[model samples]
Target chain A: MLNLLFSLLFLLSLFCAVLTGKETETGRALLDGAGAALRFCLDITGSLCLWSALSELLAQTGLSGRLSSALRPLLRRLFPRSAREDGICEALSENLSANLLGLGNAATPAGVRAAKGMAALGEGGREELALLVVLNTASLQILPGTIAAVRASAGAASPFDIMPAVWLSSAVSVGAGLTAAFLLKKLWRCYR
Target chain B: MALLSLTPLLLLGFSCLYALALGVDAYGALLTGAKKGLTLALELLPALVILFAAVWCLRASGLSELLCRLAEPLFRFFGVPEETGLLMLIRPLSGSGALAAAGELMETYGPDSLIGRTASVMIGSSETTFYVISVYYSAAGVRRTGWAIPAALCADLACFLSAAWISRLLWA
Candidate 1:
């Protein structure tokens, strides 16, 4: 998929360059892209490092486990077939907490762990997995750190002034995603 | 809103308190995780290089303008400005791709503009649907993600549409 996307975009760039008679600029843009990518990575690294480290520390302290237990009622509601003892709740809750912080780097490991747990015990079929996937994809955000960082770096007067709007849009999206997932489950049952 | 953005700092403080309470070498844990993060960031670099460059080329090649024109009517229907059409198209496929576009919008239109605010709010609200699907499904050994695509895409549409509407209502 990555290869296909890369090649397609490259070809599109070349074709457009030829059409516009701006062929020389395309090569220069590619080099500039490389530099921008590096700078972008470095800019994000500090936050990633801090958040992931704190995440690891939280996990190590067994606090995530406790938090997971605290979240049991909700997790069970989301993944109804899954049991608390199965450890799915723990990972899912941790992932949720990380996601709530807008810490995708921190969320990744927990999300991966949740996936592994679901694969092992969630023989409940596609519906269960769909719920998990929807939860992750449309997960709500409080900070929206990465986007705010971009706004800040771009010299926005107040990078986070977009937050209230972000919070509203994200809540709406997640609600929409869950509704779609529920609707799809019913449709799937009819087909089955 | 200011307090919301400070959640990360709050989490950091919580970790410090937890580490102190547990007596579990908090500094070591932090460093260990940072090392892991550094490695992960490095591994993600190649994809970034390709995506950023491709996105830049797409815009510089004037292809973005053409694509935007094609999607302009849809954006119009959603009440989003035509300038944001490229972002709406690329957002679901790639997070970095959308980020690059948003950065450009911020630079060109200024982050406080209707265009920039819409871009940021949309990017903030939606996930990279295809990317998340591939990663999470493969990791969980989920072979048949039945009905997930439409479900998630619904959410993406919600984000896209609402970002335009809400940004307009609140900012403009």
Candidate 2:
């Protein structure tokens, strides 16, 4: 019922916006927005395509496998259970690589794949998957390359200007999100 | 004329190099991903357009002015400028809008200027509230969003306070 109300309000606002302006003004704004959106879309698509291709090549060359092996120690610490499991380490490496490069579009699928690999070790249930979701959400981003790229494309004086703040905020947010997720999971378990 | 002539060549070279390095077969991957991106963009477009239009109309209709008047005292309590309240309201809906406003403030004042620093700090440190709410809650199938809204607003307030303090400490 509340969802219906929100949807109604949203639709009404959209309708009113469309009806408010003269045809010319509305057309112009739409065109401008479309152009900006297209540019943004293209940038992210290009990043994803390039990263996907690179990841494929890395897999074929066995470099990704080696990289996974190398990072296993650290990966074990991060995801203790999943580290010993097959394919988990490789997926984690791929996800981490994409994330570090700031290719979120590319990273998402790899993260999902990693989670699936992790979940194979556990029974299929909501309780088991909750931790996976939290970890994915808490995926540590050293740099928000996508947002930085967007800001650069938007003509910011210094694209790297937000780097410090991004690093700080992401660190805090990831820490807080993980802590909350853990506490909630524990509390839920206790009640159950 | 020279720069203009070189621009296309530079772009073409970059594209060719990128394609070669990535072993792009048909450019179809690019096209497919771009199509997805366009769809995502279009999905968000109506909401964004409606949001901006509503805000603009509200200001034109004097509702924002009245709200601004009402918010003056509250703004003072936070050591934020009266205009900052308008910005706070807008920031949740549109990141670009907030950034533009912040840019204007930075330019009018100096980059290291108090107001400029504050605005930049605010812009950098905060998330678009409505966007976060819509994405996270909708994905989780959360309908109430009552507690969520308050929690988010409280976080925003904390961010604002932290931003102010950090800006003063770092830049001032």
Candidate 3:
């Protein structure tokens, strides 16, 4: 899917540049494109390092276990079987909790660990994996600090003034996502 | 806004206090895990490059504008501005790209303008759906992504469609 998008973009850019007589501009854009991406990655490295370190501390201190127990009822419902597995449940709980706090950068490592743990369950777990992906991709973000900051920087008198709108739209998305995932999983099972 | 800026510090302090109370070698664990996390980011760098390059070219070459032109009527029905139509598509694919695009719109339309407000709200509401899928599934070494793409994209659409309405109801 990504392959298709990338190739199409490259081709379209070339065609557009030629049509508009802006061939030189396209070359500049290409280098600028890579440069922008590199800078973006580097910018994230600082937070990524901090969160990774924190996650490591989380495991070493067994806070993840405490966290799992704390959120046991909800985690169990989301991941019934895996919630019984201490190691996996720890990662899953951390991922979901971090995400809810709008700490997606912090959520990545734990999300990866949780995904890896679910994959270890072997066959017949594809549905669970799909559900996990959907939830992670569109999970409600209660804080959304980054967006608020952007709004503030852009000079909004009240950056978080849109929190109610964010909450409403996010809940609607998650609801739609969960329903689609459930229906898709059922249909997939019958087909298989 | 002040609280939002302090989140990272808050989380950091809480974790440190928690680690100290637990008598853990927090510093050692941090270095170990940070190194591992850096490596993961390094490995994913190529994918990020590909995604950003494509998005950049799409914007610079004006194809995004063309695509927006084609999709305008549909998005307009949802009350999104013509200039921000590209954001509805890009927001679900790349976070940084979406951020850059939103910044551009906010710059052009003023942050409090309808276009800027819609973009701002959209950022908080939607996720980088494809990016999340690729990262998680690849880390898990899962070959089959199943119905995740469709389901997540459905959520993205919901966010996009509601962004304009939500922004108006709140800010208008």
Leading candidate by DockQ: 1
Specify the poorest-scoring 10-residue window by lDDT in model 1 chain B: B1-10
By TM-score, the best candidate is 1
Residue A16 of model 1 has an lDDT of: 97
Q: Which of 2 and 3 is the better model by lDDT?
A: 3
Candidate 2 CAPRI assessment class = incorrect
Ranking by lDDT: 1, 3, 2
- What digit string (tens of lDDT, one per residue) describes model 1 on residues B38-99? 78567657766776687778878998788788988876876988887667777888776777
DockQ winner, 1 or 3 = 1
Best by lDDT: 1
Lowest lDDT sum, 10 consecutive residues, model 3 chain A, at A63-72
**B52-153, model 2: which lDDT tens digit per residue?**
443444433344456568887977676666555545655666655565445334433544466665665566556665664554444444353333344445
Tens-digit per-residue lDDT, A56-146, candidate 2 = 3333333334444566676666667776665766777676665544445555566666655644564322333344344344334444433
Point out where model 1 deviates above 4 Å. Answer: A1-5, A40-66, A84-86, A103-126, B1-18, B21-26, B29-37, B82-90, B139-142
TM-score of chain B of each: 0.71, 0.55, 0.61
Which of candidates 1 and 2 is the stronger one according to DockQ?
Answer: 1
Q: What is the C-alpha lDDT of each candidate?
A: 0.78, 0.50, 0.74
The superposed Cα distance between candidate 2 and the true structure at residue B155, in angstroms, equals 9.3
